[model samples]
Target: MEVTLLFVSFFTLLFIGVPIAITLGISSLLYLVTSGIPLTIVPQKMYSGLDSFVLLCVPGFILAGNLMNSGNITDQIIRLSNAMVGHIRGGLGLANVAGSMLFGGVSGTAVADTASIGSVMIPGMKKNGYDGPFAAAVTAASSTIGPIIPPSLPMIIVGTLTGLSVGQLFLAGAVPGLLLGFGMMITVYILAIKRNYPKGERVSFKELLSAFKSSSGAISLTFLILFGIVGGFFTPTEASIVASFYAVVLGLYVYKGLKFKDLPKILLSTAITSASLMVLVGLANVFGWILTSEKIPQMISNLILGISENPIIVLLIINLLLLFVGTFMETIAALIILFPTLLGVAVGVGVDPIHFGIIAVLNLMIGLSTPPVGVCLFVASSISGISMEKVSKAIIPFIICNLIVLMLVTYIPELSLWLPKFFF
Candidate 1:
């Protein structure tokens, strides 16, 4: 009865178009009322959920990403991308992918990557004779690399929830993140040849040198975050704060684009985004509290093992379940609600939490690019002025590319874990 009420109220709110945070909070309230749990527990769990030190990184990183967006880093990145690949057979198309990969390293947020890079690159690509839909598609697909890379907000949350080291997860993400970029680049190459997109004039050595010199400050931000983590100088949470400070410095000093007045706005925006995530985290904890109070994890685990005890079969089933949830649910909400339960089962079967986390995030990130309510896809479509249908069609090949990379990361645990074990 408790389980049925939990599921029914949650799905009812979700399907009716309530905000994710509200849906979570309201549904959990419903469970509290019916399940006869003391309502005082709600305040405690919500407070505790939002009280973690690691969560501080999210707001700082978000502000940093916003500042970078407004700081004119986008233009510099495109110029650098142009100088490097603008003369290839499908240079502009390839540039779009390359630019997103580079920007992803800085922003640590895919929507920011897509909006900042895509706004500039999409129009540029079309002017250079690439198809509009293709440009939109490439931007949408390649931007998914943002969260897969270090200083990623999702990675931080996964660390906090699973009790894994944030630094280790950041290290693990580096190789697979680059692999995703390479896969997208390869996809663009094939598409360019097939469509016969116009080639760009090769950049001269002087022009290449100038572009490199100009973007030096923006480029350093990437090194700061990467080196801070990989060099053992800081943990992921600390690195995020450092990266945030670096982004502000680059914007105000090196770029001279973001004014001092902008700092207040940036901080406010970051606070709002961070607060939203924290609310969801609180509500998810309440909901999960309801589940654990009922021993739902043990019950579900026994039911699954009774059906099939094979570890591979169990993993496959879990993947599908997560994928289905991903299509409609926000990634963080999904993570908060399901991951605890899933993590328990995975560990019971001897799966590595870090390894499972990489695959889990990768699969769910794909959901950001998928349809109906894919926030990333919607952001790209809005920026390009392209219809969702057109963008969806354009994304098919890129989706294939992302899937291929996803499979590699999923099956070849070495790709994801190699850096972590090697460095730390």
Candidate 2:
């Protein structure tokens, strides 16, 4: 009866389009009322959930990303991307993917990547004579790489939840993230050939050198975050602070892309975005508490194990289930609601949590490029002025590329794990 009310109220609110944070809070409240648990637990748990030193990283990274967005770094990234590959057939399309990969290091969120890159790329691609849906598809699909690379907001949350090393998680995502970018690029190359996409003139050596020199400051932020963590100079939280500070210095002074006047608006935006995520984390913790009190993880473990004991088969099942759920679920909400239960089962089967963390984060990212609740998908489609259905259809090949990379990361743990091991 408790579980029934818990799930029913949650789904009801979700389907009806309540904000995710509110849905979680209300569902947890419902379960408490019916299950006869003290309501005080909600406030206590919500506080505990939001009170984490690690979570400080969220606002810092969000600030850095927003600052960079406002700093005119987008055009430099595009120029650099084009200079590297613009001469290739479908070079602009390739540049879209490459720019996202570069932008991913800083944005740490796919929607930001989609909005930041899509705003520039979609119109530019359309102007360059590419199909609107195809342009949107590439933008949306490639944006998922943002969190899979180092300085990932999702990996930070995952590290907080699992007590895994944020550094390890960052490194673990490197290969798979790059693979996702390269895979999409390959897809674009093939698509360019098939669709007869236009290309740009090859940039001269002087132009390439100038572009690289210009964007080097922006690209260095990724290294700063990774090296600061893996280099034992600072924690991930501190690294986020460093990332923001560095971005500020470059944007205001070096790049001249941002003004001192911009700081207030950047901070305000960061506060709102970070606050929403924190509130969702708090409420989701309350909902998770309800599920755990009912031994839901154990029940889920038994349910899944009842179907298969082999780790590979079990993993495949979990992957397919998450893929479907992700189509409609917000990534962080899905993480808070499901990661613990899934992690428990995976660990029991001898899967490494760090490896599983990469897989889990990567899986939800795929959803971000998917429909309905896929924020990046919506952002890209909106920019392209195409319907989600059309963008969805155009995105299929890139999705296939992402899936292939995902499978490689899943089955060959080395692809995700090697960097962590090599560095550590």
Candidate 3:
């Protein structure tokens, strides 16, 4: 009955278009009211949720991403990518994927990736004679890599929930993220060739050298983050702070692109975005509390064990459940709520949490490109001035490519574990 109320209220509020944070908060609050729990607990949990030292990474990373944008990094990345790949057939589209992958290593947020890259690439692709929907599709699909790479906000949230090492999770994500990027590139190339899309001309050696030189300063942001994290120079959270500071210095002094006057707006935007996501985490923590109180995880574990003692079948079931849940719930919300339950189950089955975390995040990341809620899809459509219907149709093949990669990460634990084992 409690579980029923939880789901009923959550879905009801969600159906009525409540912001995800509010939906979660209200649903959990309803449980409190009906069950006669003291209201003080709400404030306590919400405050506690935001009190994590690790979570400080979220705002720092977000600000760093924004600062890098202000520093003219995206333009440099695009130029650098074009210099390398523009001579090939379907090169510009390939450049979009490659640029986003490189940029993803820096920004670590899908929405940021879509907005930053799409703002540049969509029109660029269109001017080059690529159809608008296809341009938007390619941009949207490639942007999913943002969170899957290091300095990811969602990984921080998930790590906070599951007690996994954020650094390990970040390292685990590298290969899968690259695999997704490469898969998207292949998909775009096949489509570009099939439709006879325009190819860019080869640049002269001098032109290539100039583009590389121009982009070198901005491109260094990626190296900064990768070096800091993988080199053990800092923790992931600490690395975010370092990255944010580096971005500011680069923007203000090096690039001279963002001035002192821009700090107010940038700080305000960072605060608001950080506050909103933190609220969702707070609400999810409370919701997770309610689920724990109701013995939901135990019930779920029992039910799964009853149906299949085999670890393989159990994992398969879990993968499908997460995939469907991905279609409906926000990824962060899903992560906080499901991680506690699923992590335990996976561990009981002798599956590594680090491996599962990568697969779990990649699966949900793809969901952001799926229908009914796909934030990335909406962002791309808005940027491209295309309709949702058109973008959805355009993204179909690319989504398939992503799903194939998701399956690889899911079934093959070595892909995720190798980097962390060797590097960490």
Instruction: Compare the candidates by TM-score and give the number of the best one.
Output: 2
**Per-residue lDDT for 1-424 in model 3, tens only?**
6668888999998878788899999899888988889999997887887788888888888899888888788888899889888877788899999899988988888888999999999999999989999999999889989889776778888788768888888888989988999899899889988999888889999988998887777667666776677787887778788888888888888778889899889999989998898888898888888888898889988888788867787788788788778766888899988877887888888889999888788888888888766889999999999999999999999989998998888888999999899987
Q: Predicted candidate 1: what Cα RMSD to the true structure?
A: 1.9
Could you tell me which 10 consecutive residues in candidate 3 have the lowest summed lDDT? 218-227
TM-score of each: 0.94, 0.98, 0.96
lDDT of 2 by residue, 143-256 (tens): 999999888988988888878899999999988999999999999999999989999999899999999999999998999999889999999889888989999998999889
Return the clash pairs for model 1, or none.
none
lDDT for 156 (candidate 1): 82
- lDDT of candidates 1 onward, in order: 0.82, 0.90, 0.86
TM-score, predicted candidate 3 vs. hidden true structure:
0.96
Winning candidate number (lDDT): 2
How well does candidate 2 match the true structure in TM-score terms?
A: 0.98
Q: Count the backbone clashes (under 3 Å) in each candidate.
A: 0, 0, 0
- Tell me how candidate 3 scores on lDDT: 0.86
